[model samples]
Structure formats: structure tokens, C-alpha cells
Target: MKTELIITTYNNPKALNLVFCALQDQSRMPDRIAIADDGSGPETKAVLEKYQSYLPLRHVWHPDTGFGKNEILNKTIASSDADLLIFIDGDCLASAGFIERHIELAKPNAFSTGSVVRMNAQTSQNLTEEDITSKRVFDAQWLRQNGNIKGLSDSLKAGKASQSVSRILDRLSPVKITWSGGNASTSRSQLIAVNGFDETMRYGGEDKELGSRLLNAGVKGQFLRYSAPLLHIDHPRGYVDPEIVKTNRAKIEETRKMRRRWADHGLDRHISA
Candidate 1:
């Protein structure tokens, strides 16, 4: 099955650049890519143009909603056209085979989640050969464009060995959740089933809520083992605004409670904290 990438972004051109680079690296590229731009500038547009020819790119913009990027993500996801949708943050980069793995298991009515490796913003902004070699960051410029994945951990190298005995014994999985916000995939039907994400969700908690709905629907999510990995650039360790975070957390808790109710009533919501 073919796939589509639905990436959400605002004014962050650098992150979008990295993400686009990663998308280029996929072994089997998507039929199309939908970018939900929340009022970016000419710089962002310029960067996107560089990759337009590589993949069919579709971009839509909403009047700046003033909130975080979650609402725009929902809108983008809703607007995308593909049987399989792979979602990633603008600041994160997926491994070369990430999309291939996600497409391999995408179900008509199930959501699949994968793992995220965080990189400090310093590493993200000023990435170097060391970072890519050490597996500290995902260098889209290198990994996506240049086929570079050197200097990764021995464990990762061991896990990804193409023709080693390690490949045989490495069947064990490392993904803990069937769904995570940073890197995940789902079918259009499964996402539309829950009416997409709660557009009202402020941010910071949309993944858990949507994942709950998947469980309630009895959707089977197959973790990509170690095959589907995402490198996340750390940004300030979450929200610093106490009030904003407090409010969002309260909403997040409410979302969790709602999922629990779904479980209690007639859903199979199962996501671990």
C-alpha cells in the first residue's frame, strides 16, 4: 500500500527543512505530502520548494489560530488523501525505512505508534557529522539525501545489520506504545472514525486521546519493533508557562478520563504512561 505524509508546522522553517529532508530518504516515498502551514513566512515556502519535485507536495494554510499546532495537524490529517497516513512533528526526523515499516502494517481501522529519540535543540540547530554518527540526531541532509547513517550506536548498527546473525535474533521489539504523537501512522478510516483529533485539544496531549479511541475501536497496532524510529529535537522540555501548561494538563487529564470512560463503556483504550 502507498502512503502519504501529513506534517504540521508553523513558523519553524529549520525544523520543516529537516523533516522534508527526512521524507526524501524514505526507501519508498509517499504518493503525496500534505503540509499544514500555520502562517509561515517566505523562508519556509522557499525551503519547501526545494523538495517539491521530489514528491508531490500539497500545502494548505489556516489563518493563524494563535494556539499551538495541534488544531492545524488535525486539519491537515483530515484533508490528506491516502490509505495510509504517516504523521511526524515538524521538528522530528524519521529513519529512512520509517515510512516503509509504517505502510507495511497500516490497517484500515487501526492506529500504529512508533518510538522517538530526542535530541537537544543545540544538536538539532547545529547538527554535525558527530551527531549523526553517534545517533544523537537525525540529519535529514545526510540520512535522507546522502544515504548517510554512520556512527550510530553499536546496538542500532547491530539491530539494523542487513546480513548478520544479529538481524535474526533482533526480532524483539523496542516500541512500548502502539501510538505516540511524535511518530505514528493510521488509516484515514480509523482517524475519521474519532472525527480526527479533538480540535479543541490545546496540545501536549492529543496523541494519548486519539490512541485511546483506537483501542476502544479494537484496532490492532503493531509496533515497528526497531525498524521505525524517529529522532526528536528537544525543545525546552515541554511547556514552561505554568498557567498554560496547567490548563492544558487539566484538559489532558480530562481527555484521559474520557478515554477511561470509553474503556469502561465500550472501547478498548490501552496506552501506558
Candidate 2:
């Protein structure tokens, strides 16, 4: 299947370079690397220019335009020519066999996916070797080998639980939802039917909202449990709005409500695993 690796970026040239290096090693090289970039600094452009001469790459950029990731992503897909679309952060590095694994899972009405691990740059790990899968993640090998990566006994880690939860809000198996936006993939047709993503959303909740749409669409989602293990480089979780947390329950309820709305109107169908 013709596929495109879509990476969204904003102000992180070093991370993008690391990601490119990983892509170069993919067992199955993507036909094209479509960059969905919001307004990044000049340094990022320079880096991209250098890489463009040697790789099958495309750069999609827009004005700072304030919180326009969803919009940019939506348009990028509409303009691209790949049947399947794989989304990864520009700062992320693909496992050696990442592309091969995803292609291995391509199926109609079925979206193949993988898990992401979170890591930090301040760590003392080997950036070159460990960077094969992802730099930010520390114990990526163990997690990928075991088919799961978890953070310290804290809250969110690089494993099946959060990765699965981040993708979906309902109790759907296979299509695991996750909070981390590092590892996730779906078909281009499915995305277009839902109008891509809700552009109104700015900060967080994009992934959850998208998952809700998928569940409603009856597209069976399956976690590429053993295939694509991603490293979600850990970053400092900044202060979120008190209301976003306080009204968390209400948000879930609202999500369910919207899910019903989509289903009732013959819009999207939700499937169980």
C-alpha cells in the first residue's frame, strides 16, 4: 500500500533530525515524509532544507496562525496522495522496522497502530544507540521487546494502558487511546470522513476527540501490540487549567453525548475492538 509518514512539528530541529535518521533506517521506507508544521523558527527551515536534498520529503507550513495544528494536518492530508497516513511528532524517532510494521498491519476498515514511550533529553542515556527508536525514551528496548513500555510507578508511562486509553474514551479494545501524542495512525479515508480533526480545539484533547470520532465510525482499531513500539520522550507536564481538570468528568460526559450525536445522525459508528 502506498503510504506517507506525516510528522507534525513546531520549533524542534534537533528532534526532527533524529527522527529523519530513524526514518532512513526503516525496513520499509515511506514513499514520502509530509511535514505538517505550524510556524517554527528559521532554524527549523534551515534544517529541513538540508535534509530535503537527500530524501523523499515534503514540507507543509503555515503562519504562526495560533494553534492551527488540526487545520494544518487536515489540509496536508487532503493535498497528499497516500492511501494510508501515519502520524508521528516531528521530534520522534521511528524504530528500525517502524514503517515495515505499519505496512504489515494495513487493512480495510481496520487501522493498525503502535504504542509510544515517553523520554526526556536531560537523561544520561546513549543518544545515538537509544535514539534508534526514540531519544526521549529511556528504557525503549525493554518496552518494545516486551511489547509495552511504562513510566515510573507514577501516572502515565509508555505502555499499553495509557497508550490505549489515549486513543479511545470508550471500552473499545484494539484501538487503544493514549494521552501522549507520539504514537498513533489511521487510514486517510477514515480521517476525511470525520473532517479530519476538530479545528476549534487548541491545546489538548485533540487525540481524545479524534478517538471518539473513530469509535463512532465503526472502524475497528487494533493496537500493533508487538509491532510498532514508539518512544514518547518525557517532558515537563505544565500547569493545566483548573477547570479542565475540575470539569474532567463533565468532559467525558460531553464526549459521550457527542458520540451519540454522531451515531444517531448516521454519522460515525463506534465498534468494540
TM-score of each: 0.75, 0.74
Compose the digit string of candidate 1's lDDT tens values, residues 1-273: 657888777777777777776666678778888887877778888878887887789886777746546566666765666778888777777666777777876766667776655554455667643444354344334343333333443235323445234233224545345457777888876766665665555555556666766775667666643556677655554434566556756755665566641323111121112
How do the residues 198-233 of candidate 2 rate in per-residue lDDT, one tens digit apiece? 565555665566666666677666665444656544
**Candidate 2: misplaced stretches above 4 Å?**
124-181, 236-253, 260-273
Top candidate when judged by TM-score against the true structure: 1
Consecutive 10-residue window with the lowest summed lDDT within model 1: 264-273
Model 1, which residues run further than 4 Å from truth?
128-178, 236-240, 243-273
Q: What is candidate 2's TM-score against the reference?
A: 0.74
Compare the candidates by lDDT and give the number of the best one: 1
